[model samples]
Target: MKKLFRKILKYGLYTLLALFISLNLFVILSGRFYLYKGIANTYLVGESGPTIYDLDVFAYSTLEKGQGEDLILAQNYNKQKLSAADRAFMESMETKAFLVFKGDSLIHEEYWDTHDKSTVSNSFSVAKTVVALLISIAVEEGKITSIDEPVATYIPEFKNGGREIITIRHLLSMSSGLDWEESGKNPLSDNAESYYGSDLYGLVTRQKLITQPGETFNYQSGNSQLLGFILEKATGKSVTKYAEEKLWKKIGASHDAYWSLDKEGGAEKAFCCMYATARDYARIGQLILNKGKHKGEQIFPMWFYHEMISPSALNTADGIKNSRYGLHIWTYMAKSGQVNYCRGIKGQYIITVPGEDLLIVRLGSEREANITLDPARKGDKNYIESVRNKVGHASCLFHYLRMARTLTK
Candidate 1:
């Protein structure tokens, strides 16, 4: 009986070890090393998953400050406050920073969980707009002659496949028609590859065209990263360096921004991962609000800004027109006005209300489970309730705009 018990224990231990080895082998063979990283940085560290503060995982290139004047946004802390319910909602959403600028003056500013005015967090997909801005700047300077130019013009390897027909306009409008389905939870997803895998160029250029370019609006991070590569190819400068020379210097940013890389001296993860304070982000908001002008200096072309803000007339799966996205920017109709904004995956928003001259920046880790950060969590409810004609935009966003209007008047 003693020998039998001992044998049983030994076999149980062996079986567990074998299973663990098999899991590791499967992960390694599947090109999903990010799973290992995800576990180590998340579950092992007592986190549910990656948070905004996980920027240290990768090396970064700094957008070194040039001659940025202090941002024109005058700071007027505590001039107003959100309603208690709104504040509770923001707090529950794990807000790190909430800032509101009415015209040129900051009316309300608050922070939570040790995050301050200077706390730099991951910008996630908000960097997409930055990419758009860079593309326009390149165009304005004749570095990129036309948005209608074939992507193959810069990346020669794309010339053979159906990818050759994909234009910069398609990418900007999220209508590239690439065979990429973004999913953060799926270790095997294209987003996982772009976010965690080492070869951005190989991952992006190799995608097969599944749908005809410019026929529909299917949001894919690969589109933005591919544009990043094109920006590099056209401007003859790294994305970070070009942004420094054009955007940061022109806007007079108050903080040094960092763009995470796939590896040392590698491509900037331009689909996401720009890190900067919320205050600096509002500087960008003011640029959009002012239509390419930064306190009197024209930072970007006004026509380009208009083009960037105009929504692409692409059909959704249901054949409804896509009103949510513009050329790398996003829009939703708020009761106050149309809200054009840059968004990151984990609730990072740099919003501009053009009609009211309001700029709001909200940065945090969680948006809401109902809004589906993981894509798999997307619900059956397709459209959000709205005061105007339904835009079919993010339902979660309505709260922010409502709160902004409710701020002490």
Candidate 2:
């Protein structure tokens, strides 16, 4: 009996070793090395995927502040009260921060789960808005011709493979039609490579044009990363430096923000991964409220600012209007009027009610998964079933908007 048990153990060990060898070999040959890193960072760590708290997990470039400090302070800071129900909602969501800013002052601020006002968490895809802003700055400076220019002019790899027709405008509108899965769940998807793999340029350039550009709205991280590469080529500096010199310093941000790179001295993860405090993130709303002005100086050109908020004439392949996502910033028109917001995957939001000068910032660990079309408000001309925007608003947005309106009133 002892000999038979030893024989079973020996065979099992040999089988496990062989399986491990085959897995590593396949990972190398397929160039899916990110799969191994993903496993180590996620499954082995007892987490499902990357969280907003992962700033130190990767290398980053510091976005330095200029020689100034214009703090955001209000007499009513933390004076605004939250109802028990609203507080419970935030607490149950594991929210790190929730702040409401009225013009240049913070009216309400709250943090949970050991987070404070100075906590700098990952800003996920909210950084996409930052990339869009940087591109606008490049155009304003004439570093590039215009948003209409073909991407091939910046990245030579885009010159072929049906990618030549794709213009900067298409990418800004999330209509690049690049063949990217954009799924974080799939270990082999392009999203995994973008987040974990080292070669950002190669992964993006290798993508094939799956459809004609500017026809339909499709969200993909690759489009944002491509814009990052173009921004670097056009302005002759890294996105972090350009942002620091141009927007970050001008916005009066107190805490330093970091943009994660694929590696040290590598490309910025322009699709997402900007680490910043909630107060600093709220300044984006003030910049918008002032019509792209900081300290009374125009930070973005009026034409470009208009483009950022204007409704796109594009639609989903299913024939639904895609107005909410315009020039990389999300918009919603409700009874409280139009609100523009930048959203991250983990429920980080910098929402601005442009008409009322109200800005709401929320950072947290979860977001609504089933985002569906909301009922049309006062100014929705195309509110019929035929043109109802099924992708306009997430349910959580409405909750936050309601709370903001209630508190402000």
Candidate 3:
């Protein structure tokens, strides 16, 4: 017994040591040590995709500078009353990046420790909003006829099974009724395996529908992936290319954005894995805020813009209560007014408040409690819902603006 115990203890120590060495090697090889240098240089040259850094430049170039812009430079609010603890909380959040703009001018910008204006933080599901934007542009350009059209009209393979009934509108609202498990930590779950698996698109598309299309509002990443496939089929070009020609270039994005391709490279994962600086992401929010217009150009049909942000048909008062989803964006009722946001897993957000002419972008590493809830007690089948309520990207920015409003009053 003593010999066995000794052997087990020795092996455990060896395993722990090996894990430490492997992690350090991964950090080094992945260029995490040189992340800041690489990101700053790369993003400035327009390499990173869909991030706050990119949006900052877009906002500054477009909006008129004012007292809010000065607050951005001060790194502390002069007019707004923010407690020391609140400021510290914002700074301490892991790898956080944020930017606020009012009618094209930057009012506030922050990048926490080890984070800078140029870091290409992952937008996660916030990429879905970009996908929606592209789809809208495609429709405006006559590449796509209407949202009511069956997805099978573009992707013929979807004609069979429940997919035939699915529409672009269904996919946008996450009401396609696809049986997707989006829990990230569960290895057996579809979303978790897809993220780490070799064939993400395949895994997602293979899923069968659990409910009839547009009958229920189930958040599913597979819906976004399917949109990418459809977009590619309709345009005969990659989603990234379409975005560059119709949206990014037209919007005057200062940085190049990147979308992660699947193993087959036939489709970009429109659900997640877009990389851009903070400012660039804000540009997207601003575009939506402006009803898909840049300068004098109508980037997308104004009707399509209204539909994308309008409440979905599938959502119920009890189902979403305080929050409503439209297309790929999340809508919230703020203290000041109604707000809509494009949110991503691990706390990435791009918020647009049309009433206030406000746009806010936030990107960050996974927050401990933001993504998932604690595991249920053993044998308790009722899974405890996550405590992290989805907060709109506009929430913080609105708070600051409200403060500014009060001060002026």
Candidate 4:
């Protein structure tokens, strides 16, 4: 018995040591050690560069304005129960910041020692949805003829790899049927390595098509990156510059937004890596919820807004297995009804319930393991699923808030 116990203890210690080393190595290799700390405030200019503000000053100054109808205090809500699971999950994950906004008000916000509002959190695939918005704008402007047009007409590089038949619509809906994978945290994977390396755009564009375009649904970040390339080719401007001029400035966004650039600085990633403050992120959500109208201006064409929420061709039976995909958006049909969202890796989300006149944004670390794994795999699962679940729950909170309003009336 003593011998058996000694062996078990020795193995346990070895396992623990291995896990610690693996985690440290993962962090170092991923270049996550340099991310900013704490949630800071920022000012957005229509066509000007972003001006960052200190969190402490912004919080105190904004609080003095006396919580307006648009602003909500974090202390008022019962977050202890509402977000207990999410909080615990975040503690376990390598989350640097978390923020939630309801309507035009910030309901809850928190940041780690290494992250702040001023620190730009990586957007991951959320940038795809933003690119969709740009495409819609371009279509309305008549820069790109239409979604039905073959993507090869705009970007010739796609002509060789059975990509000539793909349509702009296919890329928008993630139905490009391209052969690519985005296994998060897999260093051997293209996306995980590109996060720290250079020329991510070239890496993605060089991939070949696996299935006939519009025949199947494949979640490929490369498809979205191709869309970025097409947009730049069509408009004669970079995605970042175009977005700042048309959308960011017009929306009255109170902060500057930043987009991660490729090695050559020619391609701004449209599939991922956009950073903005919680309030500003919510403002973008509000614009979508209001059907791309802000302060009585039709910032985005109404037809574009309609297509953004409505199902696209790729979401049909012949496309991807998940029939809930819209134009770079995810459609969630629950017992209550249908809601559309823009989701990012590591649990970033912007959920819009049009019928409910609600919008919710939840940003945090990955939490998949917390919700999907059994006891043994829980620690290693990275907690992404759990954070995603919290995003869903956070949307429900908006429903409850509406219910409370009705009851008070």
Which candidate number would show the highest lDDT if scored against the true structure? 2
> Candidate 1 lDDT (Cα, whole model)?
0.83
Better of 1 and 3 by TM-score: 1
lDDT of 1 by residue, 1-409 (tens): 9999999999999999999899899898986776776667777889765578878988789997666565444555576667788878888888889888788787788899899987889999999999999999899899998999999999888898788899999999999999987886775788877777778898887888888999898889999998999999999999999999999877878779999998889999999999998888988898899998976888878888888888888886644567777899987754557779998878899988889888889999877532222234334344322222234455657788777766625
User: Which model is ahead, 2 or 4, in terms of TM-score?
Assistant: 2
Give the Å error, residue 315, model 4. 7.6
Candidate 3 Cα outliers beyond 4 Å, as residue runs: 1-5, 9-82, 264-266, 315-323, 366-409
lDDT of 4 by residue, 1-409 (tens): 9999999999999999998788668667875431111111111223111122222221111101111124345444425233455555556654554444445544555666666655655566677888888888888898999988898888777787788888999888778877677666554465643443456556766678777777555577877888888888888888877887778777766566677665444456667777776666666788888888877898888887877776555433321234356788877654466677777766667777776666666556543431222445445535534333232233433433343233222
N/CA/C clash count, model 3? 19
Judging by lDDT, tell me the better candidate of 1 and 3: 1
How well does each candidate superpose onto the true structure, as a TM-score?
A: 0.91, 0.91, 0.73, 0.68
Residues 1-409 of candidate 2: C-alpha lDDT, one tens digit per residue? 9999999999999999999999999998987887887789898999999888888878899997666466567876676688999888888777899888778777788888888878889999999998998899899899989999999999999999999999999999999988988885777888888998888999899999988889888888999999999999999999999999989998888888999899888999999999998878888767877778988799988788888887677767534667677898887755548778899887899998878888899999888764544444424555554335325466788889889878777
**Candidate 3 lDDT, 267-287, residue by residue in tens:** 566777777768778778878
Candidate rank order under TM-score: 2, 1, 3, 4
lDDT of each: 0.83, 0.85, 0.66, 0.63
Report the Cα lDDT for residue 204, model 2: 91
**Candidate 2 positional error at 387, Å:** 9.6
Q: Residue 354 in candidate 4 has what lDDT?
A: 74
Q: Considering TM-score, which of the candidate structures 1 and 4 is the better prediction for this target?
A: 1
Candidate 4's TM-score: 0.68
